[model samples]
Target: MTDEEPPAARRGPTWLIVVVVAAALAVCCCSGVIGLTVAGSAGLLGR
Candidate 1:
């Protein structure tokens, strides 16, 4: 075989896909909290 180099390493682990998805879901859930906080001061939504 030739002396060609292999591809570079990934930034994260492959098995962490589940964890990554869960983390993304957690962020989405937290976004609703942020929206609530922003609108809470404006009295758009109930506390």
Candidate 2:
């Protein structure tokens, strides 16, 4: 049998990666805002 390496798998498209990163950032920002609002309302954060 030949001792040759197999071909590597291809990665996803650049646009898809950008969209995923943007979505992740949006979710993170939204969650942070919500958390801060909740904390403020609960008087945990000083005004």
Candidate 3:
């Protein structure tokens, strides 16, 4: 039998972790700003 080097394992998730975290933070910040604006506008209009 021939001895061969084992194939290297794939590391797709390690690469994508940074992208996922950044995207999540961006979405959270955008939504929070939008929500605060809407709530503030409604409150001002209600008065």
Query: After superposing candidate 3, which stretches have Cα over 4 Å from the reference?
Result: 1-12, 44-47
Candidate 1 lDDT, 9-46, residue by residue in tens: 33245547878899999999999899888899989886
Estimate, for each residue in 1-47, the C-alpha lDDT of model 3 and write its tens digit.
Answer: 23332222235665578789999999999999998889888895465
What is the alpha-carbon lDDT for the whole of candidate 3? 0.75
Report how far residue 27 has shifted in candidate 2, in Å: 0.2
Q: Model 3: clashing residue pairs?
A: none
TM-scores for the candidates: 0.55, 0.71, 0.62
Per-residue alpha-carbon lDDT of candidate 2 for residues 1-47, written as tens digits (9 for 90 to 100):
23332222223456678999999999999999999999999999988
> How many residue pairs clash in each candidate at the backbone level?
0, 0, 0
The Cα error of candidate 1 at residue 38, in Å, is 1.0
Model 1: CA > 4 A from native:
1-14
Which ranges of candidate 2 are over 4 A from the true structure? 1-12
**lDDT ranking of the models:** 2, 3, 1
Please state the error at residue 12 of candidate 1 in Å: 9.1
Identify the superior model by TM-score, candidate 1 or candidate 3. Answer: 3
Q: Cα RMSD (Å) between model 3 and the true structure?
A: 5.4
Top candidate on TM-score is 2
Best by lDDT: 2
